[model samples]
Target: MDPVIDVRNLVKRFRGTRRTAFAPATPDSLALDHVDLAIPEGQIYGLIGANGAGKTTLLKVISTLLLPTSGEVRVLGHDLRTEEAAVRSCLGLVTNSERSFYYRLTGWQNLRYFTGLYGMDRTTLERRARPLVDRLGLSRAMDRDYRTYSTGMQRKLAFIRAFVLETPVLLLDEPTSSLDPLSSEEIRSLIAEECQARDQTVLLSANNLLDVERLAGRVGKMSQGRLTPVESASDLDESLRVARIWLRDPRSRVEATLRTWAGGSPGRPPVRWEVQERNQRTLLRVATEEPERMLPEFLQFLLGSGLAVESVDLRSVDLEEEFLLAAREAEAEASGASP
Candidate 1:
């Protein structure tokens, strides 16, 4: 099946200004490196990245709000450049910024105005938008000027407005940035219902990994303009695990052995490790991107190295940790993107 969103070797760069004619020139900033992505139809695809990591850059390019310096991008099989209008018609985007909505207008008024952009009439707007406003706990404040609403309330309004369009594809950037925990969960539930029952396709970007882990059908980590998509949050978390090997004698050859293994060899995949002596005990924390496939061999190598077997503890990396590892891995490899 063709993907709802397709991006190939996408690159977005910002030109930098020079200080002086005699001074050295600054290179352009690379917001998006070579990125390749394919998001399937009718799925919640979660995108995560650090600040300046290119999450919003990718969304803007796919939404056709910003043009790529080079590379191909298609939305719902529509070329982003040639079919920008059609591609935009297929999307309902909610960006996370307090100023996006009008401060002078009421929440209800803002919703109506946005829906009108899609040619929605008053009756159609009132019918579809009111319930979402109420469902998001904006019923009381919908009639008040948006400037009077708190930041959280405005955020909730921004989320509700997207549904007014009822488009086939949604591009959300921090959909729950300022919401309370209960409200955040409510938005997630709404997203699930919309996607599963209506067959909508959503690409959501957020800083909170736990939210992504819970709501996304598939997960992706974006760093330094490259994206890596995973089948499941479990696939990313489980495949990349953190293991701590404790030693009664921190002075054992375990450190040397693990270091050597971590170093690149002719036939071995180097396992990342950090060694330290903590509280009079030696600690070697090893991280493997493919833990299920590598930990056993790592353990055998440990035993055979004549290291004292004090104890071994297996732990899983959280969403934040998983992103860090994935980001570091991407930067180190600096390879092209993946689906």
Candidate 2:
């Protein structure tokens, strides 16, 4: 099947001028480098990165807001370089930036202004906009001026503006940043339902991995403007993949068992297990080269050693952990090549 968005060796660079009259101009900043991606139809893809990892630049390029320095990008089989207008027309975008909306206008007015851009008739626009406004908890505030809304409220309005268009492709940057937990859940649920019911293809970039994992079918990690497709433990790090077993083990027995396992316990691989105590319960964090392969054996060792196992189910890798691990690997590589 053809990709909804295809990018090949794409690069984006920006030039800067000197601040001082006598100073030379600053070097060009490479916002993206050799970034290749293929997002298929109807699947949600997520990009995880730090503050300056070029995630926004890559998305903007795909939206044709910024042209690529080299390489190629195609949106729904249309070349971004040659066919930019078509790409823009197909995309529904809502960035987290505060400047995306007009604060002087009411939230309802803002959305109406955006829908009018898409050529939605007044009747049709009113029909589509009402439900979204309510679902996003913007009903009462819709008629209030945008500037009167709080930061979180403004963020919700941004979501409404982007989604109200109902375009086939949705480009969301930090889609749930400023909201409360329940509101965030609502936005996430809405996106999930949109994907399932509308067959929409969503490309989202977020610092929150838990939300990303919940929403995206596939995930990518970005570091220093390089993007890597991530699946399983090795995509981040073997040690980074871990499972926690929470159980109530007596102090004397737990202490002795941990010592033996840290040493050469019988029939057990020399893996790392960290023990923490919370609310009169113990959490044993078991680290392995491969979590799926070693989980059973570790569990057996725990039970066989006369300890109760409460849960091996609470094991997972989240976005913050994965992002920092990728940054470490990138830094190590750069340091090794320096000499």
- In model 1, which regions exceed 4 Å deviation? 21-25, 244-269, 273-285, 289-312, 328-339
Superposition TM-score, candidate 2 onto the true structure = 0.74
lDDT per residue, candidate 1, 67-161, as tens digits?
Answer: 89999988888998888899999998888787888889988788878888889898998898777777777888988999999877877777777
Q: Per-residue alpha-carbon lDDT of model 2 for 1-339, expressed as tens digits? A: 989988999988898776688887787888897999999989888888877788888888888888889999988888998887888988988786867878899887887788888887778877877887888778899889989998778877777677767778888888887777887788888888866677888888987665687788888888778898877323444335667688788655664676666355555566555555778778766555577677787677778788987777534555555665555445544565210
Candidates' TM-scores?
A: 0.80, 0.74
Give the distance in Å from residue 203's predicted Cα in candidate 2 to where it truly belongs: 0.7
Candidate 1, residue 333: the lDDT equals 50
Model 2: which ten-residue window has the lowest total lDDT?
232-241
Listing every candidate in turn, what is its Cα RMSD in Å to the true structure after a full C-alpha superposition?
5.1, 7.6
Cα lDDT over the full model 2: 0.76
